[model samples]
Target: MSMFDNISVVKKANVYFDGKCVSHTVQFPDGTRKSVGVILPSTLTFNTGAPEIMEGVAGSCRVRLAGETEWKTYHAGESFDVPANSSFDIEVMGDPYHYVCHFG
Candidate 1:
């Protein structure tokens, strides 16, 4: 799916880590929500309230989920799952990492 259809988007952006990460909430007609965002070149940790699937849209990133030791790389068209109430470390270098976050 190259684009989303019949969705409502929040006008304000969700800024984090001093704006290194930014996203906007997109709500679907079925009441599901997702976020489309880009992470600037940096290494950051994010805590999740709900379980999420991080789908890579552009560029690439190295991620280490909570309790993990090894780092795995995800490029465009790849995805990674994060558990609820958990955290993950993401490292994005050179180009910004674009992603769509599917929340549950």
Candidate 2:
């Protein structure tokens, strides 16, 4: 799971939050798509169109899902699910957080 084989990557970067977050689309042979990206040290909100599984690759982050009061921490090799049409707040400090977003 460290690398993806037989996949196509979109050349254009998906940049947001004044460049606080940047990612590129990775398409698989089966037509599923994912995003590989890094989130710089910042607090940000993201809205999702599709149900997603956020897999951490490096570093760590504190996440507060919509309507949640407690913030949870996720490190490398951890994953969190976000429901479709919902949003979450993520706070990254110190090192940049690297992740792969699986879309369903």
Candidate 3:
């Protein structure tokens, strides 16, 4: 099926981090959930329980995956992967970091 062909059912999550992040949580028929949100300029670390794909939807940001010292940049339409049971650092640039996180 094409994208958005059967996307009429979706759920909204409460404003998180005092509105710094907001997103729509979508659950497909196969039981996968994806969170799409925008992250304000901030430095944060995240741990993943399941494998995730974080895609940049608007602004850009820098990320340092676990076991790496160098930071890589990801711009709009780009994406990065976080392995299950691992952590990563996120450095938001000058603008909001709009993203869609796909979980499996």
Candidate 4:
């Protein structure tokens, strides 16, 4: 099979919340395979056993791990990884918060 054969374009979503706009593009591969997600200027909390990479392009935000009361800050040109099975929350803290997320 071609490298991208098993990949299917799932859907695209745009969301607006708390005066911020986010765009999401989801892609799914074959059986039990990991999916890819692209997000723009969005805060997310993961509830499954998937690893993710979040990158900041502009503005800033904070990430709070599950069961933790502290937040780790991220700014423009910064990136962080979310371990498998971990729960985390993010919030945009500065103007024109822009970020990208890739999950699998």
Candidate RMSDs in order: 0.5, 0.6, 2.6, 5.9
Candidate 4 lDDT over residue span 8-97, tens digit each? 454655554543555544444544333322233567665537787777766787888788899999886788888888878877643655
2 or 4, greater by lDDT: 2
- Candidate 1's C-alpha runs over 4 A off are none
Better of 1 and 4 by lDDT: 1
- Tens digits of per-residue lDDT for model 1 on 64-92? 99999999999999999999999999999
Q: For residues 1-104, what per-residue lDDT tens digits would candidate 2 score against the true structure?
A: 78988999999999999999999999999899999999999999999999999999999999999999999999999999999999999999999999999999
Better of 2 and 3 by lDDT: 2
TM-score result, candidate 3: 0.83
Candidate 1, residue 1: how far the Cα is off, in Å: 2.5
Q: Lowest summed-lDDT stretch of 10 residues in model 3?
A: 1-10
Tell me how many clashing residue pairs each candidate has: 0, 0, 0, 0
The regions of model 3 sitting more than 4 angstroms off are 1-5, 8-19
lDDT of model number 3: 0.82
C-alpha-based local distance difference test score of model 2? 0.98
lDDT of each: 0.98, 0.98, 0.82, 0.62
- Give the higher-TM-score candidate: 1 or 4: 1
Off by over 4 Å in 4: 1-11, 14-21, 26-49
Instruction: List pairs with backbone clashes in candidate 3.
Output: none
TM-score list, all predictions: 0.98, 0.98, 0.83, 0.57
